[model samples]
Target: MPEAHIARTGPRILVFSTNPISDPGIDLVGSAHMRYQPGVVTIPVPCSSGIRPSWLLHAIEAGFDGVFIAADGGDCAFVPDCTTRTAKIVDTAQKLLTEHGHDPQRIKMAAICSVCAEPFVNHMEKFSAALEALEV
Candidate 1:
């Protein structure tokens, strides 16, 4: 029996959180990414929107597969426009990546509310699968 091989393509996913990982009540997400730690590296940012263009470019230059910005939505306790701007940059960056002949799928954006962890995990899986398809 031949097992299908999965090529690990795409920049290793970096999940940028607008809130600190140390914050309480962040968990409620059991099966959400708790099963296996794949290529995802989580970095807690002040605000997902605060990520600069240079930083994103630096990440790509550093050999990252891709960067995924997931910001706080619904009730934005910190800044109202933070996640909005993050979404904007994500769109802008994807276009830039496509312009450079790179797979624009390298960048992604998602808004996570209190109960959206499961969906978040789902997106991660889908993104990873899409990356795999791109390799084919």
Candidate 2:
């Protein structure tokens, strides 16, 4: 088979999606033919609250222009307080970015539901625009 080609002409975003919640929504964005930036990528985790702050920093250090946490919010099956925990994670990650001389705005978080394809695509577009504006 011919090698697949992906155009990387935009801000790169690394997304952490909760497996039981946001992941399905992100997947639906593709399966439903919703359009988003080509540089957007995703990794599914068991819970958004479980994401390590270091991972967010690593994504930036590894060349991703921004990191987006697709939080499970109140829909998390694994943790009742997942939204609160994830918010703390985002806060810590933003502080870490700031301490490293990176803009705290490079990271964003939002709740995405199981069938929220349009919202996911919208978030990606807006996040990509915001990252481009940062121009770092």
Best by TM-score: 2
| lDDT values, one for every candidate | 0.65, 0.92
Question: Model 1: residues >4 Å from true position, as ranges?
Answer: 1-11, 20-33
Error of 2 at 114 (Å): 0.7
TM-score, model 1 to reference: 0.73
- Per-residue accuracy of model 2 over 1-136 as CA lDDT, tens digit each: 5577655599999999988889999989889987887788899999999999999999999999999999998898888998999999999999999999899999999999989889999899899888888995
Report the lDDT tens digits of candidate 1 across residue range 9-92. 443777766664211112435534453236777777666667775566566667777777777654566667866777778777
Model 2 C-alpha lDDT versus the unseen true structure? 0.92
- Which pairs of residues have clashing backbones in candidate 2? none
Clashing pairs in 1: 10-65, 11-64, 11-65, 11-66, 12-65
Task: Give the total clashing residue pairs for model 1.
Answer: 5
